[model samples]
Target: MIVPLRKCLVPEFILGDGATNLANRYIKFFNPKKVLVVTDRGLKKTKLVSNVEKQLKADNISYCIYDNISPNPRDYEVMEGADVYRKEDCNVILAIGGGSPTDAAKGIGIVSTNHHHIKSFEGVDKILAPMPPLVCIPTTAGTSADISQFAIILDTELKTKLAIISKTVVPDTSLIDAETTLTMDKELTAATGIDALVHAIEAYVSTASSVITDMNALEAIKLVKQYLPLTIKSPLNLEYRNKMMLASLLAGIAFSNASLGLVHAMAHALGGLKDAPHGMCNAILLDHVIDFNFESATNKYVDIGNAFGINLDSSNPASSKALLIEALQEFKHICGIQPGLKQIGLKKADFRELAQKAYNDSCIVTNPKDAEIADIEKILEYAW
Candidate 1:
C-alpha cells in the first residue's frame, strides 16, 4: 500500500483547557521587543485580548493593539497593519480574534515584508518568502484560520475575496483558550461550529485526501458531532468548549493540506458578494454540498457516517447516502442553525450573479466533483 507522504506541521501547537499561557511562554523564544496584536473591533471588548495583554504585561512585554479590522477585513486594513508592524519594529504578531483578524495578520505579514500589492499574492504559492513570525490565539471555535496556511482579504476595489494560500501563512503557534470563546454570541457559536463540520466533511472526502488527513478529519467530525450542540446549549461548559476548540484546530490542519471542497468555494463567493457572515454562509451550504458530492464519494460517506455517529446497516450505497443526508439535516436542525440563503438576505435574483463568481473561485478546483455554473446555481437555489 502506497501511502501519500505529507508533512503535518505547526511550529508550536499549545492546546488544552487553558492553554492561552502558551502565548506568554512562547513569547520568550521569539523575544520581540514589540508585538503587534491584530484583531477586530468586536473582540476588543472581550477578555480574550485582555488576557493576552495581561500575559504580555506579566512578562514585561510591550505590544500595540490593532483592533480596527472589520468582518470582511479589507485589503487596506492589512496594509495599514503592516505599516504598524514595520514602523513599530515589532518582530512578532499576536492575532487575537477569529478568522478575519488572523487572516488579516497573515496578509499584513506577507505584503509588509515583500512590498507587493496584496492582490498580487492571490492563488497558490505567490509568496515565496517567510512572513513575520505569527502566533494565533483564536477566540472563536470555528474558522480555523489559526492552523491553516490560508488568508482571505476582501479586495475593497474589486469587491471580491482574494485568498492567499501559502505554507508561510500558517501561524507559528496556536493558543486556543476555551475561556476566550465564551464571549461569543449564540449565533456565532452555531455558525462557527457548523463551519467546523464543513471543514471535517470536506477534508474527509477531499480529492487529495490521504491517510494522515483522513485520520484528523474523521476525528474532527466525531468531536464536532458530540460537542457542537452541547456547547451551544451550555455555552460556558468548559468541557464541551475544550472539545470544540480542538476540533476547530484539528479541522483547520486537516483541510489546510487536503484542500477544501465546493462548499467553501461557493460560500466564499456568496460571502464576498453579500458581505455576510462567513461561517453562517458555510452552515447554510454545507448539507447541500455534502448531498451533491455523495454520489462521487459514497464509500467515504461510510466513514462520515461513523464520524457523525450515524448507524448505517444498509449495504446499498444509495440507502447509505439517504441515511447520511438525513443525518446531516438532523445535525443542522439539532444545532438550531438557520438554513436558507434568504435568511441571510439572499434572494433568487442574487443567484445568477453569485453563481458566476462561485464558478471562478479557486476552491472549486479541488472539489470532489466538478460543479459547473448551472450546478452552482442549482445549489444556491436549493440552499435559498
Candidate 2:
C-alpha cells in the first residue's frame, strides 16, 4: 500500500485577532445541544474567561463552566467533569487554559461519551467511541495540547501520568488568540515556552521523524528561538506573544505526529513522583537528556545549535555537542527555570526507583537512540 511518511490528524484551527468571537459561527458545524466550558479556577477568575463568556452569552449559547481542575489533574477530576457534562446535557466541550485543564477536558469528553471509566482505556487506540464536539482555546503559549490528539492525564492514585493517545482526542475546533497569553507571569510564560521548544527539538530528531514532521519541528524551533525570549521579557507585546503561540502550535503539530522522546518520558516520571510542575520538570531534565543523547546524534545536535543561532559550522562534533548543551543550559537560565530536581523538592533518594519507571515509559521506544536503565539513572543524576 502507498502511504505517507507520517500520518496526522487535522483540527479546525481558527486563528486571527478575534478568533474567540467566531465560536457562534462554527456552532452549527458541531450541532451540539449544550456547551461544557472546561477550565481552571485561576482562568475563570481572570478576564480571559469573562471575555469568552461574554461572546458565548451574546450568542445565547447554553453553557456550564467547570473550573475546579488542578495543576496535575487527577483521574477523579476526569470522572467529575464527565458527570458535569452529562448532567448539563452538554454535547459540546469547550476547553480553555493550559495543558492540564485542556487535557482534563479530553478525558471528560471521552468518558462522557463512552460511558466508561477513564482509566479503563489507558493505552493506544483504546478509545473506540467518538467524543463530543470538543473545542480547545489555549491560554498559554506552550503545551501544544490544544491541537494535538494526545492528553497527558494523571492517575493521582498511582501518582503517574498517562499519555491518552487517540485520534478522537484532537479538538474539533481550536481558538488560538495570542492576546490571551499576555497575562501569564514571566516564569510560567518562559517555562511553558521552553517546553514548546523541547517538543519541537525532540520531534525534529525522533526516530519516527518524517519530512512533514521535520518541516513542522524545524519551523517551530526557528520561531521559538526568535520569540520565546521576547515573550518572556515582554509578555504584553502582541507580536511576541503571537509568534510564540504560533511556534507552540507548530511544535504541538510536529510532536503530535512524530511523537516525543526520553526527555518527556523521563520528565513525566519525575513530575508524577515528585508532583513537580510539568514545565519545570521538563526544564530540569532538558540539558541532561540532550547531553545523554549527544553521542548518538552529533549531527542533530549541530542542527539544534544552528537553529538557535550558535555558530557551529567551524566547530568539531564534540565542540558542537558541548555548544548545544551549553545553549540548553543558557536557555533554561535565561528563562529563570529552577536549578534542578533537587531544588524542586524531589528527594534524590527516590531517583533509583523513579529511573526504572521512566525507562519503562512508552515514549522511550521511539527516541532516536534507546538507553538502558543505567543510562536513565545517569540522566537523572545529571538533572540532579
lDDT of 1 by residue, 1-384 (tens): 888776665456777767776687887688888999899887877776788889999999999998879887888998888888889888889898888998999988998779887889988888978987898888888788988978988887766788778888988888777778887777889888988889888888888877877888898999999998899899988888889988888888788888887888888888887888888888889878877888888778888897789876436778888888888888888888776889888889988888887787777777889999899999998899
Worst 10 residues of 1 by lDDT: 4-13
Which has the greatest TM-score?
2
Query: What are the runs in model 1 whose C-alpha is more than 4 Å off?
Result: none
TM-score of each: 0.95, 0.96
Give the alpha-carbon lDDT of every model: 0.84, 0.84
Superposed Cα deviation of residue 318, candidate 1 (Å): 2.2
Mark the regions of model 2 whose C-alpha exceeds 4 Å error after superposition. Answer: 1-4, 313-315
Please report, as a residue range, the 10-residue window in candidate 2 with the lowest summed lDDT.
1-10
> Which pairs clash in model 1?
none
Name the lDDT value of residue 326 in candidate 2: 88
